[model samples]
Every structure is written in structure tokens, then in C-alpha cells.
Target: MIEIVARNGSPEAMLCPAFICDACRKQVMEAGNVIYAVRYPDQSERETSPLFVAHKGACDMAVQQWLAANYPVADGWSDLWDEIDDFLAYLGGNFKRSFAEDADGQYVPHVVVMPATSPKLP
Candidate 1:
């Protein structure tokens, strides 16, 4: 997945522009409704991967649940697997990651603001 983070800290919500939601297929009208941007890498020969725009609460919950269910504990850390919730929370609260699709249909990086001329549709 493509995850971009701010160099200094989390991105200011108000400064982010609205985009079409990759999860719900709706317009993400405000910053308050954004969950996070998740870029799924191509598993085959495709040049670009799909970027998904998650809704705030619902998408966060879904990601957490998926992490909990699918992520296995590492070799030496028994407690690490149980900390997925905290990890996800930290990413959401401490970073500036967003979704951006490229010409190859991959969600690339935009560490701060969305690119001025980036395509809006996913």
C-alpha cells in the first residue's frame, strides 16, 4: 500500500481538499469525513495500483478489524500482534497520508497537499 506521511507531523484536515471516496463511491465533502488513503499495490504485471479513499469512522474500523483478523504475530513478539489497534491509531493521528491515483491506476504519494493537477477520479 502507498502511505505518505508529512515530514513534520500530521496533515491539517482543513487544508486537505475533497475527493471521491474509494470505499463508499461518494464525494468526500469535508476533512472530518476522511478516514485515510490506502494504496493497494499491483499483484500482477500492472504498472499502477488502486488507491482507495476510506471514510473516517467506517474505514478506520474496517482496517483495524482486518488487521486484527489477518495479521499474524511476529516471530519473537507475542504482544505485537495485539497492538494493531494502537499502531493504526498512531498512523491516523500522527501522519499526513492521502490517496492519489497515477496514470497507471496506482495510488502514489503526495506527502502534503494533493497535487494541483492530479486527477480527481479514482
Candidate 2:
């Protein structure tokens, strides 16, 4: 069944998939392109854990970029770039916080990059 996740603050996904690391998850076998995913901290989880909520705009940009690039209508993907830039702009204009080291002292918002892997075992 398809699960529709609304508002990343729900309790259903506490650990919140660590998908936010600015990395691509899948690679195109034919063209060497990529598929990407992002993650944000689930508010419920953050209540007990040290995770931070991912900016919703980051998630939206990732989705739009994928749709624009992969869908049948490939020519219109330029807007995705604009959207990404817009997000960055918003950050620059609105927030003044910066990323800090985590408990293990590793850079956080740690980009958890998973290289494209083989097909799933069936």
C-alpha cells in the first residue's frame, strides 16, 4: 500500500529515513543518471532524539527535480533548478543558523550518500 506522509512531524516515522544527505540513491543503468531522496527529522522522534527537521523546501525541490528530469516531459525540468535556487535564497534571506558537528563529532546534516546498488532480490 502506498503511504502518504503529510507533515514530517508525525509519530509514525520517528527515526525518519536518513535520506537527507545531499546524495543520489539510484543510478540509471543506461544513461548513468541518478535518483535522489531526502529526509527530515520527524518531530516526534526529535522529542527524544537529537535529529532536526529537514526544511520542507529541500524535500519539495528534490521531488520536483526528479519529476522534471525523468517524466516524459523532460524539457521543462529547468524550473526545478530555479526552485532549488529559490530555496537557497530563502535560507540566505531568512535563517542565520549553520550546521554543527554531531555527537560522534561528524559533520551533521551528514550527507548519507548511498551509491546505486543492484536490483532487489526477488
Candidate number of the best TM-score? 1
Error of 1 at 70 (Å): 7.2
Residues 32-105, model 2: lDDT tens digits = 11223333344222111111112234433454443333332332112212233344466586466434523444
TM-score of each: 0.25, 0.21
Candidate 2: segments with Cα more than 4 A from true spot: 1-36, 39-82, 91-96, 99-109, 117-122
Q: State how far residue 71 of model 1 sits from its true place (Å).
A: 7.0
Tens digits of lDDT, candidate 1, 23-89: 4455543332222222223333222112334446665455434332332234111111213344447
* Stretches of candidate 1 exceeding 4 Å from the true structure: 1-18, 32-52, 64-122
- What value of lDDT does candidate 1 attain over all alpha carbons? 0.36
Clashing pairs for predicted structure model 1, backbone only: 49-106
Find the candidate with the highest lDDT and give its number.
Answer: 1
Clashing residue pairs found in predicted model 2: 20-39
